[model samples]
Target: MPDWNLVGKQHVLAAIAECDRLGSRDFLQRYRFGRARASTVWHRGQEYDSKAILGVAYLHATGRAATADDFTRGEAGAVDLLQGLGFDVVVDEEALAAEKAPRVRKTTATKPARASRSAPAAKPRRTTAKSDERVKVCPTCYMALPATGICDNCD
Candidate 1:
């Protein structure tokens, strides 16, 4: 499963207040484009489009939109905001239902070929060991002993 991190409730409230005070232009410029683009902001703390998220939350609370669809960034913003805030929100059921209803499916199983009709078997792999060679090996370790009849590991 994917991991999620949510901002604390107190932090969210403070952020929302800041967003409300800033308004749309300020919110977009600060978060969506300008200083929000700074890597330090992400590394240090949270910086997101508060206005958009707040709108979504309102739509969700009011039930004006389906739960699943209601949580969009454009319409409700709250769901995303809540997600950012670490809330486990249920997906909008009606939107999910609508999406699931339109799915097109085709199921067909093909028969397998008969064993008698199969292709010939492939050859087996070969070992490098040769019968004619005086291959000396350590009896205890099953390792090839050197010409001096000494196994380095056994010694």
Candidate 2:
């Protein structure tokens, strides 16, 4: 709950509504005017506490506040009201505990498998003189001509 004394009642109400709609207390704090100041405000010939109203509005907007009693009892009352409305109050402890537990890993050291011996590499075949004689240079493009003796580039 925050103070609403320094800021206008309408502004405080708007901030509370916005906070409730968003379901975020941080949003309210960030957008609240005179966030550093706290003062009492007179509304409808009565003192309306900004912090209390904000808290109640938050509970109501979040579907936690069912009646005026919820506002009177504060957070615990709001929780009870919310529970009465069929909301699950218990969290899954088993799942959370499992998540926190450290994982176990098996570490085994073993010698690397021996590499199989490979056969000796064969020598590359040398190009014969007849192979060179079969190739001809194109006179038009000064490029190597294919077996058809046609200059693709010049054409």
Candidate 3:
């Protein structure tokens, strides 16, 4: 319940400057922030996790490290406050799309070789779906299929 009103434009700018000096990964790690999933801040053509910047800005203003659960995100939270504080905050469409996109593994099809009468009939190859990264289980049906994402059985 610390005051967000105390956080000024200078504090946010300072946080952004510090993030630039340390790089995003190191900065986020140092501040204990997870990767930004929905929103970001743009400064000098560089993208920054908006929530991280605000959290650190709160630190700069109040000398207290705010945890993730302390405040919410999205338009009604950091985005609105940052915009009011005169900083550029964006929706991060790329990140949103990536989160929404289905994660289907890409599988390659292998053709079976023909067996000859002169040789013993070849045993059917057993596929271990659990170990194969290229195989994916269809949510609709419990069957494993090529990672095409679309379950051919259901589709």
- Which has the greatest TM-score? 3
lDDT of 2 by residue, 46-102 (tens): 333333344434433332222222234333333343344333333234543553466
What TM-score would every model get versus the actual structure? 0.25, 0.20, 0.57
State the lDDT of candidate 3 residue by residue for 60-88, as single tens digits.
77656555655644323777778888777
Measured on C-alpha atoms, candidate 1 has an lDDT of: 0.40
Worst 10 residues of 1 by lDDT: 35-44
Task: Judge candidate 3 against the unseen true structure and give its global Cα lDDT, from 0 to 1.
Answer: 0.70
Instruction: For candidate 3, give the lDDT of residue 55.
Output: 76
TM-score of 1: 0.25
Better of 1 and 3 by lDDT: 3
The superposed Cα distance between candidate 3 and the true structure at residue 129, in angstroms, equals 40
Candidates in descending TM-score order: 3, 1, 2
lDDT of 1 by residue, 1-155 (tens): 10112334543444455445566466444333222111111112434443333332332233121222223333234445566656444454465445445567798898887887787798998875321233344565433345688975578
C-alpha lDDT of all candidate models, in order: 0.40, 0.38, 0.70
